[model samples]
Target: MLLITGITGHTGGYFLKELINNKYEGAIRCIVRNTSNTSSIDNSRLNIEKVVGDLDDPEFINRIMVGVHTVMHIYNIHHSPMIVQAAIENKINRAILVHTTGIYSKFKYASEGYKIIEGKISELIKNPKCPTSITILRPTMIYGDLCDRNMSKFIKMVDKLRIMPVINGGRSLIQPVNARDLGVALFTVLMSQKETTGKVYDLSGEKPIKMIDVFKIITKELNLKTIYISVPLSIGVSLARILKILTLGKIDSIERVQRMGEDRSYSHNNATIDFGYNPMSFEKGIKIEVQEYLKKNRN
Candidate 1:
């Protein structure tokens, strides 16, 4: 049996589809919160058991780990310690844990916590007593459908604004992976335990594109008359900070705006070699995203 978590989330939906489309012949159990819409995991075609519980509860995770040989945890990386503990206790064969490349962020407050949590995970892997083979896959900014808030927010903003501000002239490089591509990497790693176990894979996009180019591509795809207004990095951050304060923290992420000037690209060559990980280009990806976004959001 395979136990999965976050199967109802953005990338989770894509991951579930991969398993079903490939006709994975195994008893599957998915851990989810009580309120999660299980429409993606609880359909008639798939025979997946939807086990509702809190992954934060070690007891809950431990209980479900039983009889489950392989575990695919697609949820919060912060909850990984307990999941790792549960996997060790149950003597699981292979555990696939999904993380983000955001761990490399230059943002002070966020990076500190991410590094600390990652440190704990690192300690688990190095510990001699632990036996479960764990593979950590770090995907860059994930965007495919509307469920992806990162790109979706920008898409919505483009629709609302006459002129979109290009921070630092969108010069800093970024490589974002599509949700389906990340899911495929996870499934491939899960199936190929020998090569991927005890390794960290940086699953980025097909190539890195300048941040300015991203908005330009969006404008092209949407066929909108949204003009570009260049905003200096410092000016952009200050405006974001001021808006956040005036909005009582509702317009948060001043740091996100600041970090827009910092490059956030990484190499996925190892992931490509190991599992034939082929990710779609951002140009092609944004085309699909615009279609999905327009269906629900456009007038």
Candidate 2:
């Protein structure tokens, strides 16, 4: 049996579709939050057992690990240590874990817990007694659907306000992979377990675009006339500091603002050479996404 976590989520939903397309015959089990909506999986034709629980609970994880040979933990990267521990303890031989490209962030606050978790997972993998072979797939900013919270929010803001506040002259580079493309890459890695085992792949979009170009594309796709206001990086960080205090640390985005000046692009040549990974260009993917958003808003 194959165990999956977060199959009801955005990327997970697409990954499940890929599995269905490939005609995977394995018995699948998914761990969903108590409040999770499983209508998509429950209504699907795949043989899936829905296990209600939290990844935070080792007891629940251990219980679900039974009869499971492969694990796909896609819910959260912070929850990886426990999942990897459980995979090691349960003697599961093969697993695919989704982490993030934020692990490479230069900002301390942003990369906090990332290195520690990656290190812990690495140590677990190094254990001579460990039986699990783990593969880590890191994806850059994921933007496809409306719920993505990255590009869609930008689109909505551009539509509503017609003004975009960009920091650092909006020159920093970002590569955002479409959820559908990332899903296909996930399935490719799953099928090539022998080649992908113990390897890390960066599943990024086709290419990197400047932060300003991102907003430009959004304005064009949404057919909105927008004004771009460029704020200096220092000023942006100061505003974030004030917002952080005003929100009682709830909106603490000082590091996020600071990191905006840094480039976030990565090469995915390895993923391409290994898994035949081919991703759609941002304009093509975002056009379809924008159309969906426009249609829904019209309805």
* Candidate number of the best lDDT: 2
Q: lDDT (CA) for every model shown? A: 0.86, 0.90
For residues 1-299, could you state the per-residue lDDT of candidate 2 as single tens digits? 99999898999999999988887888999988878888888777888999888788899899999999999989999889899898889999888999999989998877877889999899888977779999999999998999797889877887888667899789999999999998899888988998788899998999999999988898899888899999999999999999999999899788878989999999999999888999999999899889999999967
Per-candidate count of clashing residue pairs (backbone under 3 Å)? 1, 0
Model 1 accuracy (lDDT, Cα): 0.86
Which candidate gets the maximum TM-score versus the true structure?
Answer: 2
Q: Candidate 2: misplaced stretches above 4 Å?
A: none
* Span of 10 residues, lowest total lDDT, candidate 1: 39-48
Query: Which residue segments of model 1 deviate by more than 4 Å?
Result: none
